[model samples]
Target chain A: MYRQGWLGWLFVAPALLLTCVFFLWPLALVGWMSLHNWPLIGRIRWIGIANYRAMLNDPIFLQSVRFTLTYAAAITPTIFVVAMALALLANGDRRFVGLFRTLWFMPTAIGLSTASVLWVWMLNGQVGIFAAIGRALGLVETDIPYLDSGTNAMIAACSMVVWKTAGFNMVLLLVGLQSIPSELHEAARIDGAGAWQNFRHVTLPLMRRTLKLALFLSITGSLLAFDQFYIITRGGPQNGTISMVYWIYNNAFSSFRTGYAAALSLVLLAVVLLASLAQFMLFRDREDA
Target chain B: MSRNTAAWLYYAACLAVTGVFVFPVLWVLICSLRPAAESALPPAWIPSTLSLENYETLRRVGAGLWRYVGNSVAVSVGSALAVAAVAALAAFGFSRFRFAGRGVAFVLLLAAIMVPFQTVLTPLFIVLRAVGLHNTLLGLGIVYTTFHLPLAIFLMLTAMGAVPRTLDEAAMLDGAGALTVLLRVILPLVAPSLATVVLINFIAGWNEFLAALILMTDQSNYTLPVMLVTVTFGYMGTVDWGALQAATVLTMLPVLALTLCFQRYYVQGLVAGATKG
Candidate 1:
């Protein structure tokens, strides 16, 4: 290590300064903004928790929270299961495994908003592929409107999310899967363990840490989803698909309710921290058991 | 079943799965190449006729296609370079120095990774506005660099730490200064990681949508993703499917090119980050 006393401080000065100005300072400023009646272009008035109190009575915000939780509940498991399966399929150094990995992981390169726009077009009732297939298979007499109804929009958005993110988790899990020693699987096979039995007893038990990390990532990602809902549904059909981030964006930018948005941001941050804490507790308990 | 037949079946299953994922992108490419009329009709796997009308339409859309592309390229490349440069310095400091508060500062920096950007948008906006950078591309690039630092710094620290300290000590013995040693000796050793950090941050800046959308409100200042959104609602709420498809393909091109070229570094970075965390 270098003993160049204050030179070390100089090296880290830029990073520390940027982080404080952009990230840490914003965090502190948002807290202060939450306690006032700050608007887009007006004097800041101190309201002293009025925004927080108003959240209790705001129906749209409450619905947004519920709707976001529901989306997270549904999407997290879907991504996890699909990603785990892909990881298992592409785990070994087989002849075609690399090809499979690339193909699955390719979609992850596209931006979420672009992906949503593509899905919006593909799910269009009139000129969409889904409707065309449905007609070709004699499934429906006319085009199926995928984004008009709330349920359908949710389904389409979830499908898009799965397609966009499953590959990323697949890669993460693939790393974990490869870390397990191959000899353990061989021993299981020698002990007359079938594939299912080997996976159940050997793989799952060894994969707890990776699974925990992947699950946490998936949950937080789902909770913060905004672009897909904004592009696909635009919080329409009675705001059924309004996510927490989407609601926050609307209040902050669209409605120009800066103070209210700041309050909501704090609440969202608290919710995420709580979720992380819960996951940590759950994983720790399992590890101890 | 015979083992050979079982292997064949497995390959077939894998092929089918690949098709499921690749079909959407391939279909979009085909749609982009087909004539405008064919795109509006019922979907066809095979294009009866190929034309560049969609590309033509894409070029004519809001503020022109090349303008948005320029904006995206500028912002992503600028921020990626900024991230790599800043992270290199921070990594060196944290790795090579035994000064006071180094441990605490490192921990605090990594903790910034947990605070997602969504939670800080309002204040970030206000801060940018206060600094007169609210709607500028340079401002957006700086924001991207700041967000990418925590992870980049962490990764760079590990990369530099793995280098034997003896090499730098030898350089110092020969009257080499700290800056000279870092630039000439240590950086060459960590080139692979530098590439990885650049690729990760570039892809991240390219794919970012919400921040760009909220921050760049002017039509001309829109990046590719935000521009794609505007084109979707083109021509009186009726989407120009051909132009939209063409534009989407264009947006995906640079990222796909980078990933395919440096896939080893890309995957390595991801695995290292996940495992270490």
Candidate 2:
């Protein structure tokens, strides 16, 4: 297998070339663009960190950060709790568990933008099924403006994200649950442990790494959320629901501030990297203990 | 409760949860079939007269519906194949050979997985434009293949690592060249993982929004996800809910079918990718 050096290079050359051109080159260019007044068309000029300076005082940028974090906070726990429950229910070798797993995990296949469109109809005040049901059941005399206000809009977006993504987490956590040796649970039962006690002691500790990975992905995804807010709410109700990526998108595409958007993108990358690094360190230490 | 009663309760609970998860898609499917005139308030759970009229209207309204679907299929399949071939080669290299700077290169590749696409949008746009691939489907396919390489390579690496080296050595002793061994011997053994890579990459490419949005500004080249957003938002004044729902169903049909058909491998690949990352 280790016969020749050039053969290994030949095997890896295509990947390396593609990555260098697509990934590393663009990454380096992002850093370079952040320090310039790059635009869609026209002359590029060096600005020396002015874009970064402007971001500190940009209210929309700050607001987008706040909303993104708030969205992540709201959505991650919701996904985890629901996913954990779904995983437990679908864990064992029970009847019809395969069907239950498929049904629960089907939404992940649908695109985010597509899900947003479907939710728009579902949460519509006028012709939506939910609204129709509510009116028929005497819950409200009038339609509920589910996406008209900031609070309700955020809630609507969060719910759509959870609905589309919780299934993915459920599958991930199910793998973790399945990987846990049955002997641990059997031992707990031998000590007369009830369901709650066994789950609390044996299942929880064993699934720690999987839970951390799931939470990490969910939080990162929620922070980078753009399509849901963009399609569902359009950052409406006074730009209250604009996630950070959406904000960057507006700056780059709508406003044509490529340099400023590049700066914002770097800041976001830093935040995500730092947060992930912290989570990894925290989990690693706990695992060792 | 008796054991029989407890079993019944669990079954009921599982059914209820499954209903909650799947009801929205079902509702969308129903809405897609309902005629526009009857699609208004107090929506019918069961349409009085279900028809393909909404789908026809969607085709007429979104004149580019078929083109978008074609673009999506082309891009998804093209990128999936490109990623599989490139990643399999790279994974073989990493898993088999003791090359110089292999560890550093692998780590750098892994680091690319963490870098969000937003950060590279501007620069990549400029580069693609310079290369005369600004809005072409090939340009989009290349970008997708490149972006997906890291995870694809990681998954393939794991798949190849599990293969015993003796097989490769035996193949070599039988006069099979390195490329021949990779293409015939090793690849056949890891065909399942290759399929998984293709499926995962197809979904990612199919669902990709921002890249497709920025790269393919031309409507004719828009992927399904981008086209749906554009058509829905572009003609904001004349929003057709029934047609929109129909288009969404149409857009989701391929990925949904793929997932249902290959769910076992999909889940395994997803879990492997996530845990390894």
Give the number of the best model, judged by lDDT.
Answer: 1
DockQ of each: 0.74, 0.73
Off by over 4 Å in 1: A282-289
**CAPRI-style docking class of model 1 based on DockQ:** medium
* Candidate 2: pairs in clash: none
Which digits, one per residue and each the tens of the lDDT, describe model 1 over residues B1-277? 9999989988988898898888888888888999988777777888888999999988878888889999999999999988999999999988888788988878878888778899999999999888898999988998999999998998898889899999999999999999898999999999999999999889989989999988997888999999998888774577788888898889888888788777888878776766554
Interface Cα RMSD per model, in Å? 1.3, 1.5
- What TM-score do all the candidates reach, one by one? 0.97, 0.97
Give the poorly placed runs of model 2, Cα more than 4 Å off.
B40-42, B234-236
Q: In angstroms, how far off is B98's CA in candidate 1?
A: 2.9
lDDT of 2 by residue, B1-277 (tens): 8999999999999999988888988888887887778765458768888888878876765545678888999999999999999999999988888888888878887788888787688788878987899999999999999989998998998889999999989988999888898999999999999999999999989999888998888878888888788767747575677777888889888889999999988888888878775
**Residue A58 Cα positional deviation in candidate 1, in Å, after optimal superposition:** 1.1
Chain A TM-score for candidate 1 is 0.95
